[model samples]
Target: MRVRRCRESDVTTQIDAHQHYWDPARDDYGWLTPDLAALYRRFGPADLAPLRERAGVSRTVVVQAAATVDETRYLLALARDEASIAGVVGWVPMLLPDTPALIGELAAQPKFKGVRPMLQDLPDDNWIANPELAPAVDALIAHDLTFDALIFARHVAPLEIFATRFPKLRIVVDHGAKPSVRDGAAGWQPWADGIERLARLPNVHCKVSGLATEASHDWTEATLQPYVAHLLASFGAGRLMWGSDWPVLNLNGDYLQWHAVASELLGALPDAQRDAIFGANAAAFYRL
Candidate 1:
């Protein structure tokens, strides 16, 4: 398949819906070990500024890579000083008794647009569905904040139940539930069906990010087409947003490579629809 190269001029207001900036020295990122040399070091706004500039991404939503409230505060502080960081999806202990208070404090920050619980790392697949977390979830809706579900395929059914339970809470499924793209064609099943179900709910959205890390080491545009197609068909451009997944993306590819692949996958879309996935939808969804 001939892939379309993404030109920087294609979208006037490109926004990277998902990305991360972390300093391992902070000691909170448990997953940032030295063995994974590609991503073990610090990645800050200084590193991303050039890449974003080259990609024509005007603004970005920096997500929480660490699960601590301090890290959330860290990102919020970064957003305050960095004009390109449009929003910050920080972390909070949802099940704690004082979660509502924490949410209130975090939401007070203008750039704290949402919370992500890092559902993929949890042992329980149904963790998000626990009614015990209602207070935290309710606080999110009450404050008009969004939820970014960092989940795996197994968590999809539970996510559906969670979304149904809190219909008013705006949720965006990060990385399309991190599909088993490494398995190639055989990986498409339940993941695709599960995403389709989530899309049926009006409050749920999905990001076109992080697939490179989930795919085979030598992944190409063709390797990702079917999955991207399913997302486009399932959520439509209005609910599907583009994300860089950056530095971690360096594990498999670079920002420009993923951007070009995404452009090719979405090349057939109408200009308006393409623009929505590339920028407009995320800006509206995160209120950037």
Candidate 2:
């Protein structure tokens, strides 16, 4: 990312804990094929420089966009030196029995704040709610690790059950349970209700990020309002957080667009509430 001169106050000391970074040349984003390249456009660390500079957000938590352990360590290394990247939510095989010991090993690294699994893409008949995996999911709470939930509409119901099973785990729901911006309000109530139910779990939180991308290829704040509003209402400021989801969001919107739309939707809140949603909540919850 390009770093320009900025006054001390312009540099936010708080966290912007959900941006993504990928070095295309280092390794191909196997999941994002050439066809998908058009969606991402010109995106990477460089694209976010001005957003950070303008927003005065110094620290951010980088999370896994692709499900892989290497992506986690890759970001952890960045957090080691880049003061702005204060935390990381990397991916791990949480379903495996050995996952707990592995997470314990990574927990030693201060920047490794959480882990995520892209559960939404799984087959409709998948078994994420199995009792066997409960132990590994529970291990995250024991280690004070934040578990970022990236699932789909149908997955929300099961997620609610999962939250009830682990009321103490710090679970951050990314993309507001990933509603379809293209889908009308009628198609999303089930997901919204499911998320609301999960928000009842004290340890659960919601991240206001990646909405522009989740919308249809063509989207506007109006298309995203219902989801964002519902999430804010359910989780409230205390349990809410904001993220750019950077490079990934390039699939549909840029940093400035994401920030501006969020500003319009969330501008009505008090400064304290804004601070909590934008950064403080994440800092307090993840202990960053």
Which pairs of residues collide in model 1? none
Question: In model 1, where is the ten-residue run with the lowest total lDDT?
Answer: 1-10
Give candidate 2 misplaced runs (Cα > 4 Å). 1-14, 26-28, 38-47, 124-126
Per-residue CA lDDT of model 2 for 1-288, tens digit only, reads 222322343223545768887765545355765677754343445556678868667678887766778877877886787767778888888778799999998999988888887776666524567677787887788888878888776776677777778888788888787776676765686777787777788877888987777778778777888788888888887898888787777778777677667767777787777777777788987889
* Model 1, span 40-127: residue lDDT tens: 9889999988778776788999999998999999999989999999999999999999999999998898999999999989988889
Per-model RMSD to reference? 1.7, 3.8
Could you estimate the TM-score for every candidate? 0.96, 0.88
Compared with the true structure, all predictions reach lDDT values of 0.90, 0.75
